[model samples]
Target chain A: GIQVEQSPPDLILQEGANSTLRCNFSDSVNNLQWFHQNPWGQLINLFYIPSGTKQNGRLSATTVATERYSLLYISSSQTTDSGVYFCAGTLQGAQKLVFGQGTRLTINP
Target chain B: EAGVVQSPRYKIIEKKQPVAFWCNPISGHNTLYWYLQNLGQGPELLIRYENEEAVDDSQLPKDRFSAERLKGVDSTLKIQPAELGDSAVYLCASSPGGGADTQYFGPGTRLTVL
Candidate 1:
């Protein structure tokens, strides 16, 4: 079983500020994903980055599989981005995906 | 295409009562999963189904929690005589295939046992 830990469990920033969240896994993983859980509790898929880096608008994620870590970046954050961001990964040769506790972001307008 | 669908977005019941939650995975998805999330924690896998067969359920409390996916497309999770400790959010997810495929989740069913 792979354990996932997230850094900066809580973050508060003014709207338009930027932030970075990190996730570290205990072991090698075959796949990784980022999700944003909105205030309504809907887990919206952000990215499926098993490795390398990807960007979508103001959000981007980079995964260093060799280092067993991932980073998510948010630029020009908006008040709507106030929620929990989670990173989950599937351990090597395992189908189960383990998730980090989450990074709670609060963007004040 | 619609994402995972779950019914009864919220449920509130007295302790020792029975409750059930339903889930309909995305069409053509072969892997369906049920996860439980306690407040301020990550979602934990309760059961994993490869179609109609439950390949992984070691984490499920078989004594009181039971789940079924009759046609391999829709699933139902039931808690018989539920306890206060069972109060949490139950999420349903699905992937195109098993093993490392990206999983999509539903809004989840929030249950509160009084």
Candidate 2:
């Protein structure tokens, strides 16, 4: 099993600020995704970047597969961004995803 | 179109009791998954279904946990004689069968066993 580690296990920011979170995996991955778990426990898919970069609204993510690391950026963060961010990955042809410990984010208004 | 749907958003029961949760995957999605998330932790895969067949269930606790996806559209997860440690949020997700499709998740059912 591959291990995934997320940096800054906890983070707090004032609304409208910006922040970046990083995830490092122990091995190469064929699938990588970033997810936001809201207070109500809904897991929202934020990005499906196994490699390269992608942006959606105020959130963006970049994955360097060769380096086995990924970074998620939140710009002009809102209070709604307060939750746990998780990075999950799977080896090539693996059907199950192994998850990181998660980064707890708190956005204050 | 409706996203993945899960029933019984919350449940509470005494230890040793039986509990079940239901899920309806997104239309036309051929891959369905069940995951359990402990407090402050990320979701862990319990089982994965490709249509009516379960392709991966290596992490599922065979002794007390069982799941079925009849017809491949809707699924159910059951826990008999549940223990307090079984308390967690159960999430269901669906995706089009492929290597690059993003998974759509349901709101999840929170179960509390006392």
**DockQ of all predictions against the true structure, Cα-based:** 0.80, 0.71
List of chain A TM-scores, every candidate = 0.98, 0.97
User: Which of the CAPRI classes, incorrect, acceptable, medium or high, describes model 1?
Assistant: medium
- The collision pairs in model 2 are none
lDDT of 1 by residue, B14-37 (tens): 999999999999999999999999
Residue-level lDDT tens digits of model 2 in B37-109? 8987888999999999988999999999999999989999999989999999999999999443688899999
Per-prediction TM-score to the true structure, in the order listed: 0.98, 0.97
Off by over 4 Å in 1: none
Candidate 2 docking quality: incorrect, acceptable, medium or high: medium
- Please report, in order, the local distance difference test score of every candidate based on alpha carbons: 0.94, 0.93
Best by DockQ: 1
TM-score of chain B of each: 0.99, 0.97
lDDT of 1 by residue, A39-104 (tens): 899998899999999999999999999999999999999999999999999877778888899999
lDDT score for residue A44 of model 2? 91
